[model samples]
Target: MSRLTVNKTYKLYIGGKFPRTESGRYYELKGKKGNLLANVSHGSRKDFRNAVVAARKSFRGWWEANAYLRGQILYRIAEILEGRAEQFEDELRAQGSTPAAARKEVLKAIDLFVHYAGWSDKFQALFSSVNPVASPHFNFSVPEPTGVVAAVAPERSGLLGLSSVIAPIIVGGNSGVVLASQSRPLCSVTLAEVINSSDLPGGVVNILTGMRDELLPHLSSHMDVNALLLCSDDPAEQKLVQGEAVENVKRVRLHPDAPLDESPYHILDFQEIKTTWHPVGV
Candidate 1:
């Protein structure tokens, strides 16, 4: 007699809880050798809408959190990732990454989180400006979270790319709805578990695994989403996203390729600069 193994049922991570797609449909994920990797939820427009609602609802709490506290929460996520290093590496391998590459990517993802963690409390200083005005008034500009962001995670590298895109957005106090790597999505859900356990507030980061073609329109056209982050090189697809975004005049940031390094500029991509004027003397 052979022992039975219980396979994992992967679901969409929304508002800090895992739920099957409202469509109740799933697509089989396969490894390099065509072996069944897992069954991933086939997210639909409803799921994306739900995620946007969650992100919007949680925006104020995350935005009001102190910078230092946000930094600490980001660091805590990195710490959790470190503890789950082996599991991530194994999942990467299952997704067809060579053992060496898998290990390297896992480490890179962890370091990326740490890099953004350090930036959480520091980016404002670098980007904000106090103007030298001639009048009896003080003028200054500060960065504020852009609110709900909809992102399509990089399709090439599952864990590393997803981490790179997500870290900057949330660290800057903006909530996000991310469509994970369609083909290799295991690590995205796994990271959601790490986020759920961290001090970060729920609904701050929602992860959905589904086909890009099916979800892009909803993400780009949503009226409530303040911005859009696309990680693709397809001109047609880019054009489509941009065209749809015009409906709400949503800010669109396109990253044709994964960023070379975890730069603070990525955080600014989803930030809105607000200027204020104050009387210098009473």
Candidate 2:
């Protein structure tokens, strides 16, 4: 008798737990050579809805957490990701990256976390300002997190791209529900595992795997999601999301066309500017 290889079917990461899709549907994942790789959960509208609820529930705590503490949590995630570098490299290789590229991507992903960790407490100061006023009132303007952003991770790069987008979201004190790359879903679930072990609060970041077209409508139309971050070139799809977002007065940011890069502006992309006026005494 011949021994059989057990194929593992990965599930969606929601509210800090891995659960099979409520619809119990899955798509066949193929490797670079066109062989069957694994079964990735085909997440449904219900799953996206549940993720938003979880994100909303955890918002205030993450929002109010001191910046230093948030930076530490992000650093901890980098630690875990660094320890599992070889595993991420393997996943990247299977998903069509060359050995050298795989190694570089793994390193980049780790560095991305650390880079954003350093910025966690600093961006606010660089971006916030006090304005001179002619009146007796002093004016101050600051950027603050927009709660519950739902994003479609870029389709081209897997772990590197996913990390590029996610690090800034949580570091800025915003909770997120992100849909992973449809073509390369393996590393995302693995990242969820790393996040789970890194002392991040449950629901602070949610990752789901599914068809982008299938999930975009729900992510856009949901009333509870405060912002939408999308990476798509299709004009029709972009129009659809923009139209739907108007119903809830949601912020819609179409991700830039360039490859994933680290910048403090990316973090500010998810933030809203708040202005305050205070009376001054002579």
Which candidate achieves the best lDDT against the true structure?
1
Error of 2 at 129 (Å): 0.6
RMSD of each: 1.2, 1.7
Off by over 4 Å in 2: 1-7, 257-259
Report the C-alpha lDDT of model 1 over 1-282, residue by residue, as the tens digit: 899998888999999899999999999998887889999999999999999999999999999999999999999999999999999999999998999999999999999999999998899999999999989999999999999999999898889999998999999999999999998899999999999999788899999999999999999999999999999989988999999999889999999756336899999999999999999987
lDDT of 2 by residue, 222-259 (tens): 99999988877778888999999999999998875333
Find the candidate with the highest TM-score and give its number.
1
Stretches of model 1 off by over 4 angstroms after superposition: none
Q: Would you list the clashing residue pairs of candidate 2?
A: none
